[model samples]
Target chain A: MLTIHNLQKIYNGTTVVNLTELTITAGESVGLVGNNGAGKTTLFRMILDLIRPSKGEVLSKGTNVMQSGDWKNYTGSYLDEGFLIDYLTTEEYFKFIGDLHGLSGGDVVERLAPFTDLFNGEILNQRKYIRDYSKGNQKKIGIAAAALSNPELLILDEPFANLDPSSQIRLKNLLKKFREEKQMTMLISSHDLSHVIDVCERIVILEKGQVVQDMQTTENTLQELETYFTV
Target chain B: MLLTLLSHQWKAKLRSSIFQKSLVLNIILGLLILYFGSIFLLLGFGLHKILGNMYPGQDVVGIFNSALLFCFLIDLFFRFLMQELPVLAVQPYLHLPIAKNKLVHYVLVKSVPSIFNLFPLLVFVPFMYTSVMPAYGAAVAIVWVATLLLVTLLNNYLLMYFKRQMSTKPLYTLAFGVAIVGLMLLDYFGVLQLKAISETLFGAVLVNPWLAVVPLVLLAGTYLLNFYYLKAHTYPEELELRKTNTATGGDIAFLNRFGELGKLIELELKLIWRHKRTRSIAMMSVMFLFYGFLFYGKGKFMDGFGTLIFVGIILSGMPMFNYGQFLPGWQSGHFDGLLTQKNISPYQFYTAKYWMMVPVTVLAFILTLPYGFFGYKIILINAATLLYNVGVNVFVIFFFSVYNKERLDLSKGATFNWQGVGASKFVMMLPAMALPILIYLPFGLTGIPYAGIAALGGLGFLGIIFRKQLLQWSANRFVAHKYKLAAGYRQS
Candidate 1:
């Protein structure tokens, strides 16, 4: 569960993110939809405690994220390529993350099993550094590593942007399975409406760093979102 | 078109982050160039007289002629190590409507004004004015200077061609180095008459200016070689000196025993080994271990505590200073990943860096132990400085580490690189090097210098004892500054 209270981020007198209050309960999956410069990534960064908020605080389970680092223990996040160590081989990076989470080598391989389809056999055993991988492959590696620990809350930004259509659909299915089996709380931001609607039980449409709509997913939710975004 | 390209290159240099962000660094770089330039000019004017005195009865001109070949050879070796290939600058122009021939000419001609080509002229032109004009008439002197410049350009193009041809084969470079050394040794042992041959060849040019055509033709040949090579391989990846090979190094099995700390150290070592810039810094640190010889062998420095302590600090601490000045910045590429990782407390991160540097400092101290052969006193001072560096100076680096927010592009070579190097680095070095000497200065002035040396070591011993507290303090500072650092890195 995560909460934001009066969170505001401003640069050079221009507000990037301004939220009076927002909260996500346990077992809830929320998709953040926004266009470019909608402050989606900036809001995510504040929640992750990577960037200090200009006003108010982000709370992970009632503890201020900035005042404590305990949220990192149960929060799995992959916002961008910055989350991935590019110099390490895919296996090495996985092993490193697994080691941090006290996972055995076998546990690492087992957890990565779910990613096999999405990986398309191009990730592991490539014998090249992550930096040398194509953009799509690098995103896959970041996503898989973020999920390797099976953290309580998952945060990913633009998870389907660089991925091919096939991988994107596979990823959507993977997310659905994780939510169904483990009740993993997810906060995914994407420009893809249908894919986000398919995986998330709720949708929060954001504009200019403020939430415009927060509604439970329905059969007509996709049509409603498409109509809202028409202009 | 060429002018537009040149102006673009000029703008690139002027607007680069390293240049625009730090006026202090730019001034320091300018001063260094001026210092070296003045020194070369003075040597150029004074060389003929120095040679005349060394070989009293011999012709000064002949002596200069004899050394020309050796100078050129040494110059070539240095150029091989430091000269950057200008191939990548031509990449953006490749798909444009520009003529391929004009672009190739720009790449080849761009190398002519580099420090490797121009610095020698500082010496040669002055020597030509002072000595050659007096000995050989004005025409001959003019011809001789032209010949030298031709040979210099020839070496430039020759390196570009050979380096491109043998880019992937390091063995050829090694063989070339060995052959040069072998030639020098043969000349030293009198198995070859290089000096005589050099004298005759240059002496011939003095008599007949027309023979300058030899070097002229060779220069043209090498230029054409580089021209055709660039003409054929204008593709950016083909022109790249080192094609991205599969990652070579793997995890250090032994380091895994230390658990998370070991993982951090293993990652840092891999970073050093994999990147060109970090690898060169490592190599430079090794080279600097010989720094002790400069001070230790001199009797005046032997009698003094300040100079010897300075040398001791540099000898054992050069690696830490060179690498640590950019602490956390080296990890700036993946800093966000590091911050959000589970169970990687800032305390553990700093502790890992502390432990990693201690062993290297100890290793450097052991390697420089032979400096004790110079005198037991030398060993005493170095041992004290080593302790000081490990304890006090390491913390000094850690304290200043938070200010290093610039993101490093590790792929580039370290030579002439100023990326991630801010004015704070120069500021940080002042206290790290000078504080130890400051600690000793009072005792030396009081004429009880041994106590001063012991005090330096004693302070270091205290720091080592309280290292936990110091590391925790550093972590606290890092936590306070992490947002700023993250923002800076994200911008780039």
Candidate 2:
């Protein structure tokens, strides 16, 4: 569960993220849809406590996210290349993340078996560093690493952007499975309307750092998102 | 088209965000260049007199000729180390309508303006103009100067060609280095007469101006080779293939015993070995471990314990000062992930970093232990500095690390790199180096050097005993600056 109260992020006199109040209960699947400067990442950064907000707070499980470390315990986020240690091998990266989460090497080895479908056989035993991987492959590695610890809360920004069609469908199915099986709370942001509509049970539309729409996913949610962005 | 390409490069340099930020570094580098230029000019103009005074009635021109070849060889070695290929600069133009040959030509020609090319001229041209021109007729002097310049240019392009080749296959670098050393040894022991060869080559140029064609042909040959090499590899895929190979995985499995701390240390070691900046520092620090021999062998610190302790601490703590000054900035690439992870404790992170330095410092101290053969005093002083380094200096490094708000790109080479540097880094070095000396100065000056060494060591031992408290203090400081550091890392 996460709560945002009068959260505002100002950069050079412009409000990058301004949310008056919002909350998401545990096990809720939320997709954040925004345009180019829509403050999607800014809001996520506030939640992750990567950056300090100029006004109000983001609370996780009744505790202010900025003031406490409790949220980090259950949160796993992959926003961009910053989430990866680019110098490490993909396998090493996973193992390092697993070790950080108190998972043993054998446990990590066992866990990576599931990601073989997502990896598409290009990532493992590739003998290449994550830096040298193609952008799409790098994204797969980041996404897989984000899910390494199986945290309660997962956040991904534009996860489907660089992925090919096959990987995108695989990721969607993966998300659906995780949500159904473990009730994992997810906050995914994407420019792609169809992908967001497919995975999220609820969608929140952000425009110019303000939440414009908060509604349950419907049969016509994709059509509604497409119509809104027609211009 | 080349002019347009060059103009873009000029704009890129001027418009770089780093350019404005590094204005002070640029100015300092400019002054350093100016200073080196003046020294070379002085050496050039004074070469005639200095050689005359040394050789006394021998032909100075012959000596200069013999020495010129050695100078060019040394210059070639330096260029091999420092010269970066301009191939990457031409990447943006690859898909453009420009011809591949023209692009390659542009890249090769761009290297002419380098400081390496300009430096030798300052040293060589003056000596030739003032001495050789008047000694020989104008025609021979002109030919000699042209030959020297051509040889310099030849070395530049030849080294570039080899460097490009070696980037893909490093065996060539080793073979060339070995061959050069072998040749130098052969010449040194009087087996091969390089002096005779140099005298004959230049003497022939003076006899017949047309003999300058030798160096001219060599320069042109080297240029064409580089030009063709770049032309063949201009495709993005080919360039990428040449730039990087599949990374061979490394194992630091022994670290698993230490649990999370060991894992962090393993990651840090891998990062250091894998990245250019950190790799260079790591290699250079290991090389500097032998620095104690400079003091011990030369008996430079025989007069007092003060200077001895200074060298001892520096020798032991070299890696800490070099590597620790960056801290979280070195992890800027992945700082967000590191901070967001729940399982990582800041105290443990600090402890892991502090403990990593212990091995390196201990390694350097172990290497320097043979200095005890010189004197018991030297060994005692070094032991004290070693303790000071392990206990006090490492904590200082960690404490000052809290102020590192700049982000560093680990992949860039350390030479002339000013990335992620701030006032905090400069100030950090002061207490790191000064604290040991200040601790040693009191009893050292009062004729109680043993007590000073023991006191410094005792304080360091105390710090070691209470390391948990020290690490907690450092972790608290890190937490205070955590957001500021993250903000800076984001900007970078």
Chain A TM-scores of all predicted models: 0.99, 0.97
How does the DockQ of candidate 1 come out?
0.01
| Model 1: per-residue Cα lDDT at residue B389 | 93
lDDT of 2 at B14: 61
Model 2, A132: alpha-carbon shift in Å?
A: 23
Per-residue lDDT for B98-216 in model 2, tens only? 45667788889888888888888887788888788888977788789889889888888888877776767779767877887777788899998888888888877888889999999
User: Candidate 1 lDDT, tens digit per residue, A1-231?
Assistant: 999899999976889999998999998999999889999999988887656688999999999976656787788888877676565678977886787678899999999999999999999999976866888998999899889989889999999999999999999999999999989999999999999999999999899989989999999999999999999
**Candidate 2 lDDT score relative to the true structure:** 0.82
Q: Can you give the TM-score per candidate against the true fold?
A: 0.69, 0.67
Native-to-model Cα distance after best TM-score fit, residue A64 in candidate 2, in Å: 62
What candidate 1 gets wrong by more than 4 Å, as runs, is A1-231
Q: Estimate the TM-score for candidate 1.
A: 0.69
Task: Write out fnat for all predictions, comma-separated.
Answer: 0.00, 0.00
- How high is the CA lDDT of each candidate model? 0.87, 0.82
Cα error of candidate 2 at position B197, Å? 2.4
Candidate 1 iRMSD in angstroms? 21.3
